[model samples]
Target: MEILHHDVRAHNVMLGINCIVQLTNFETARPQSGGKSWPLKDKDEILRWTAPEKDSSETRYTSECDVFSFGVLLWEIVSQTRPFDKIKNGREVFKKKILIGERPNINMHMKDGHQISVASDNYFKIMTEAWSQEANHRPSMSSICERLRNIFHTNINEDEIEYTENPSKENDITALDPLTQTTTSENILTSNENNVKSKEEILLEKARQYHDAKDYSNAWSIYNNLLESDKGNAEVKFMVGSYLVHGPPYCQNNDIDKAENYLREAADDGYAKAQYLYYQLLFNKAGKYLKLAANQNYTEALYDHGYHLYKGTFERRDPAKGAESLIAAHYQLHNNALGKLNELEKRYAKEKKLKKE
Candidate 1:
């Protein structure tokens, strides 16, 4: 009765009404004693969620691999972020880092023990144990369930937990978008007790739809209107400014000066993304802003600032400070950051070897 969910990431996990947790998307699920799973070609999309051992061309993924993925999912739940989120080309970097025994920083952004619904120590143990590189060293699903039962002080049977199917037209349930943290029908940024969405919410959703549909002109118009109504909204300013910088045709796009002006305004208002974007455009002049954004734990800024500190790109070389910055970015699941750290570790190892030689 063992199941091997080839993809066990957070996006496939769903939380329904009354806090009913269900693991949907059985498209990739196979019997642990399976004959065949997904073809290797189809696995590119799930590279980040697969186990380290999946580097081989073999199609037979074991339950132990699922345990590895579950450990990653645990990291996702604790960090509330995707694995290797900011890495544009993660396959090569991910493979290299995994070969060097790198895993996500489990302690980063950990919530309070009570908030996570399990004692922090127990949760950590479970997550780390599940991630053991030796597949057999990983704990069994039953052991994990036992730990959960102990945490909750209840003898919860497998039958007691509900499993909802993936929503279909008949189900009338909208799946949550991992990026927006909202359902397709509504934005969670606003809540109305009467169940009626506010005008601003409606407009925000419309703007999002337009942007997603690549109707940049309409999206710009709506965001501009929203900005007019709420002049002090830093997020709105960032959206408007970003469109101007990188928007597609017919939306006043690629206006660097205008974009910089808007981004600078948003950056001054303490929006971390804006601060980082502003630094990008004014790299030679806005080193301070890069540091400011890095201080706020902005992932890109951390990677860039760490790179600068390490290579002295626009700052003095201080390998220690650079490593520290890269480590912070790595904790947040930045693959590029991990890549840099791996590079440093290898170099340090080589140096030590040379000294011994």
Candidate 2:
């Protein structure tokens, strides 16, 4: 009888008497075929173990999904720790990593001072195969059972195996598949003594990755969550404010009022870039904010403030000071500063030409 254990996790497995292992949690289980599909209303319950496809509204629980969850369970057995233990939001994991085809690290558990044995290697290989992003690419339960039986029958002694060290930067762990690389999310999560990154920083990195990949909705979600967690965080405020101003597709509708409020908060909190952007939002009426940002050596702010001063766009045009600021911006490789300086010269020449006319 083909069965699909819809929910597969370490908690659902039981160790019976005489070392007999039995799987529990039949509440969500159904036959592999000929069952009424259930709607995905409460995905949060199994988001950590479910496959990437399970996040979709139209997807139905399948044997392949169970295989993916089993892969996570296998990792738990080998590592003796929960996957993504520090992360509370499973949806964030799905959006930031899994949906992009990244998986949990297979080698992170190596630091536990365990000897590398053939059985452990085979276990990791099977686990990775089961976690393949494409459901069809994952091995069936029968194939998984065969592999498990082979490992059990091999009778590899752990004591005879030589101890192996955890992977260092020079010797990074590569996945079994040639197409897959070392676990990116694991690398992000791994904290070192020298440069320990906070969870907030990791999320920000994920947000930037999403933005780079053009997954704007996820990026916006992460930023908004960060802001909610820390309302006074100037960096998140600037990011959220900028996103609200531009309003990328699937992010949200543009709300200038909200954008201005966020920008103003960040600006008042002494964020130089936010000060400059806030000035722009105010129709450049707040020259003080622009000047403050330029004083901080903000490249765009220097170029814009200098150009406006040179063009007499302010109450008192100081061509010398403007030229000074433009030169500083040019030294910093501000692309527009050189062009603006050239325009300044052309404008002066035009004035001389008009004198003759």
Candidate 3:
């Protein structure tokens, strides 16, 4: 039955009498078919907490994958912070970084300036093993249980901590196969004292993780906290405004008017993304904001602004300025701008040769 509980996260767990934990949620489960690969449906939000192998299309997943996820669980127990909390695109970046052997922040295990350590280095070591890249290298579920028992049962400041048998019940964590150096979104929510990281830095990181998870409501909550602390932050303001513009999944409602209010504020602060977004919201009527963004070397803005410069549609016709901006955009990975630059350069060369001839 434990094997059947495939999606083991905070949400799926249930508590019975005497605070016993029970794993629920078999949505991703399949019959014991030799731990082979299955067609992953749509990408799940759980990817924030999922194993790298499970995130892969190449490898077949085994229970070892669950061990990897358990590592994230341990992280949650320690940090109470979301995995990749500073990254807005969690899974995409997680895949790129984790697949390349990068793991989540491990600062929670030790404290230089933040609150005292919740879990010791020994526990951190065990977690790193769980999230090891090689699935076979991870400890079996039994070993994980045994080790946790040793830590809990031993006199390691039990006064500061409380342990529960079943993780499914209430706030108590059930230790099945905890291993990993980093925590993920679906793990237990842990909170620790201040560390070397500033409040805004910490909050921003968590907000990124929540945003990446598509848990927009929670992300917004974090955003609001930051906004209250620093009302003049352009990037944060832009994100909130952008959320309003995009609507649904990011925001509950698409309030363009409110979106403009925030976005304009960010744009006024000279934030390149905000300036471009404002230009877009105004039906491309405002070339100045677009120009402002392009001047800041914003890739999309450079391309569009260059296009307008060359075509004289919205801005004045200035081939020299257009070509210069297009050239810069070309190097910034704007394909259309590169193409336009190439065409213009070729035309210039041909015309020069013709004049000489």
Best model per TM-score: 2
Q: How far is candidate 3 from the true structure (C-alpha RMSD, Å)?
A: 23.2
Best by the lDDT measure: 2
Pick out the ten consecutive residues of candidate 3 with the lowest summed lDDT.
187-196
Candidate models: Cα lDDT each: 0.73, 0.78, 0.71
What tens-digit string does per-residue lDDT give for candidate 3 at 1-357?
A: 345334545655678985667767666776555554344453454666677776546756567877887787778777876677677665775677677777778875555666533346657878889989888889987688656644442323423333333235344343332552235223444432221345566566767887898878667766756777768889889988998898887866888888899999999999999999998889554787889899899999998888778767675778788888898898998878888777766876787799999
> Tens digits of per-residue lDDT for model 2 on 1-357?
787877788988899995678999677667887686554444564677878887676787788998999998999897787677777787777777777888777878676788767888888899998989999999988789767855653433334333334345454445444454546435544533225545566666767887898877667777877887668789889989998888758355888889899999999999999999998889645676888899999998899889878877754877788888998999999988988988897897798799999
Steric clash pairs (candidate 2): none
Compute each candidate's TM-score over C-alphas: 0.39, 0.42, 0.39
For model 2 the local lDDT of residue 130 reads 95
Over the stretch 1-357, how does candidate 1's per-residue lDDT look in tens digits? Answer: 777777788878999986768999888677776558855444654676666776786635888888888887888988888776766555854586554567777656545643543466787789888977777899987678657544432222334333344335344344443554355435332333345554555666767887888867666777777877777878778888888888576365577787888899999999999999988879855777888999999998998898888777777777789899999999988988988877876876787799999
Colliding residue pairs in candidate 1: none
* lDDT ranking of the models: 2, 1, 3
Cα displacement (angstroms), candidate 1, residue 350, comes to: 99
